[model samples]
Target: MPSWDNTPSGTMTAAALSLPGAQPPSKCFTIENYYPKPTLPSQKWVLIKVKAAGLNRAELRGRNGDQPAPPEFGMFVDEFHPDPPKVLGEEFVGIVEEAGSETKFGKGDMCTGFIYGGGKAFDGAYAEYVICPAQRCFRLPETSLSWDVLGAITMSMWTAYGSLFEAAQLAKGATALIHGATSSVGVWAVLLARDHGCTVIATTRKKDKVAKLKSIGADHVVLEDELKEQLKRLAPKGVDCLLELAGPDTIQTLALPNLAKYGSVVVTGVLTKQWSMKDFTPALIPPTRKMTFYSLEPGQEDIEGVESVIADVISRVESGTFRSEMFLDKTFPLERIGEAHGYMEENKAIGKVVVTVP
Candidate 1:
């Protein structure tokens, strides 16, 4: 088996949080070099030389101590240790530096995937190297897409795919409403829905992003305040599917009432930072409408299911059906991850903010 002895370093620098609270974004993180390079625990794992890692809201929640306790059925329970000084990142794209005998990946293959217990049970992609289960990783297609672009898309695209197709069963010719349309996942949802032949109506809080959203293939782009009025005009029968990414703030006020009689609302993201809805009741949902939640958590699906969804997304990108470059908002070096998190918290980014590892 290949070993870290062959690599350039015995230890690596990683962004870690020693304390979790509402501290300054930069203050919450520290670059540490004392941690030893992680070894593959078993043949089912691979060691990656990470080139780029994607920033996610979940990490921010972790830093703020806002993440809820793991569910009883959580698959990573055995590995999880949410103590301070944890590395924080969920998605990455990199070269397979070392692969186990049982895995299909080999040295030098480009790969991208999500880490379910990243920053907790396992060291995350915020470092120069990360260990991932072979089953959770996907080989990237031979394409011209940049590493940052690939990193940006992995988790966001996976979430969008699961919400649109797996959860909602969105069909061709359906009218889809993407709430929080300027978010990275929302952007991917817009593209996926449009590619699937749905008439997409995207909503954004900022008026400045309207043109950008429309250019990316949204049939209509409306401000959140104007959603109902515009939807009435554009999708009079109500939308066939609603992707609620803004979370509790918009779910009752905007998402539910605008759904078609038989529409499905898939809650895929919580851009608002509000975890629960105020006074939410069963009566909020109409009789014929359905509401569901989709997450890329472990145990949600099998390895084959994850591989299939990622492959479908990659195939679309390779075929030019989805423009990978259109989804990247910014790239920050690992040293500047705090600034990247700040940017995301400000809601200033139109798409994914990626952190590149040196």
Candidate 2:
């Protein structure tokens, strides 16, 4: 009576792309009926009706062949299955349409989460339906946080959380230097760090965004070129931590000089889109300093920690103190995914770009 093929009439649509190749966004990304709605893979997974998904720089780099396939490539729904034309979205907000036995969530429960392998190892939230581990997903409260805001938070907020707390050990009264202050993660880091009682020194290349960054809890905003000089005036004792979201060039030129003895530096992103750092060596850092690279790619063992942080972030977002909406620069219909990717690739977007599924 419950036939698999009898479930739905239409196929799920996604912005599909090829891998290990470079092409314009228009040519690389195409909207098509990419996948049929996926079935529950196990008692630990759930099928979601995706509402919105955020486009990230990782997906862009993967599409443009700027980065190679992750080692986990070809694994779909936790299996070593080779499925391609991959659907490209990593972070999303959706409603649980079907749930397995082990999940606390039931059918129709609204949810949001980010997964490292989504859009890579399997079909991602760019589709109308996506299947992911229920443990990797979190149920959301019926609150004022909209779908777009929830989607945007999945990647940027998680990175900010891990960078500030786990990687840098940022504590109240610490001083943080946030490179690339205009980025979505940079903006969130400034807010999150300030809320945690740290004095934030934010940096930006655009003079126009100085006031904007300062308004979001940055105690001091410095131009990227003037980072070293301004930092000396602002924090003569030196920065206790630096969230290096910029490229290696900034880390070499601006960040190292301002680091305090015993300070920590967390490298999380490459806004410069350069993966390799030329003329850089570990010896360049002071022996007293600590360096950590924060990545959201966690194994099964780290799920509880990820869940705990997501819960805390949701509580903060619902409290109205987090202001998640401020970081959304633009949103597009699913069909306009190309334009969205183009906007980010061109470095025109000031914050997160989201794709809204109808």
What is the per-residue lDDT of model 2 for residues 267-337, given as tens digits with 9 covering 90 to 100?
88776766566788999887788877786543533766766676777778788777665577788888888
Which residue pairs show collisions in model 2? Answer: none
Q: List the residue pairs that clash in candidate 1.
A: 17-85
Instruction: Give the worst 10-residue stretch by lDDT in candidate 1.
Output: 1-10
The TM-score that candidate 2 achieves is 0.84
lDDT against true structure, model 2: 0.75
Per-residue CA lDDT of candidate 1, range 118-173, in tens? 65555688998898877778887676777787887888887888899989999899
Model 1, stretches more than 4 Å misplaced? 1-9, 18-24, 69-74, 77-85, 278-284, 297-321
TM-score of each: 0.87, 0.84
Q: TM-score for candidate 1, please give it.
A: 0.87
In every candidate, how many clashes are there?
A: 1, 0
The root-mean-square deviation over C-alpha atoms between each candidate and the true structure, in angstroms, is: 4.1, 4.5
